[model samples]
Target: MVRWNILPATCILNSCIINIYDEGDCIPPHIDHHNFVRPFCKVSFMSKSNILFGKQIDIVDLGEFRGVVEIPLPVGSVFILKGNMADVAKQCISGVRHRRVSVTFYKMDDSKAPYRFQPDPELEELLPYQL
Candidate 1:
């Protein structure tokens, strides 16, 4: 990610979570925890879908919801979240028609790391290209 300048040198992504979504599977709307650093990102794969963003996402029914805005998430694309988008607005993916996978990367606050968490030495001091 650093080589592509997707993330700056100051932001080291040390943690990741993989999400697998099956047909009819939906993700509830919520903001990322403060324990995780900002400027996080989710890379999509396998399928295309829409991500909803709003201050309040209302559940209309099982696998249904109402959001203020929607954004298309194409396969092999990266969605970066920072500032208010990471801390204020909530995001969710509605029930998908096909299997989908996403890998989310973020920097975890040192003080909030899990009890057994150990920082990976390889991810330290990641520097983006000078160009």
Candidate 2:
């Protein structure tokens, strides 16, 4: 990931969430919570879809919406979310015609960590592999 320049060397992803989208499934436009650190990534799999971006998204109908822009997310692709795109703009995925999966990776702010949170030692000092 470092070689691809998707993340800086100083950044360490410590949290993850998986989303499975079924047919006609959609996500409303919204920004991520402040608890997550910047420069997170969403990896797409199984199918392709357009990720909508806009300051104001209009709900046209059930599982349908209109946005200022639509970015295609291809299968096995990594869509990095950071800076203005991650903080200022609201993003959403429209209803998919088929099953799709996405895994998002984030770094939880240390100050926002839960009391029961314990750092995983194994994830520390991870270095990129040499192909």
Candidate 3:
């Protein structure tokens, strides 16, 4: 949670939408920080494929050691989480090798996603390549 003074804060997310495909449409391994704002995120899963959610997330409601989070989500199964949790989920997602589309709904830090008032050449370069 460190912030710089001189360097203008970067617009991590902005009003951008990242949708990639892998034949089986597999996304890369990373966090959802560059999407929305706030310290939380949400995603809606829709597919008949064998969907799996990695990392051991202990749901207070469910008292069981769930392996990977495998969901047979029909068409609109919404999964929500806090910002930090979303980041962790992204890490788990990175290792997934399958065909699925993760429709994410979350926020970013610093500013509201694209908090950058203007343009940042450095972050701009890191933008295209980051996704």
Q: Pick the candidate with the highest lDDT.
A: 2
34-82 per-residue lDDT for model 3 (tens digits)? 4455433234343433333545533322222233555543445544444
Q: What's the TM for model 3?
A: 0.40
Reference-based TM-score of each model:
0.87, 0.90, 0.40
In terms of TM-score, which candidate is strongest? 2
lDDT at 39, model 2: 88
**Which is better, 1 or 3, measured by lDDT?**
1
Position 114, candidate 3: lDDT: 47
Flag clash pairs in model 2. none
RMSD (Å) of each candidate, 1 decimal: 2.9, 1.8, 11.7
Models sorted by TM-score, best on top: 2, 1, 3
When summed lDDT is taken over every stretch of 10 residues in candidate 2, the lowest stretch is 119-128
Q: Which consecutive 10 residues in model 1 have the weakest lDDT in total?
A: 122-131
Between candidates 2 and 3, the lDDT winner:
2
Instruction: Give stretches of model 1 more than 4 Å off.
Output: 120-131
Ranking according to lDDT, highest score first: 2, 1, 3
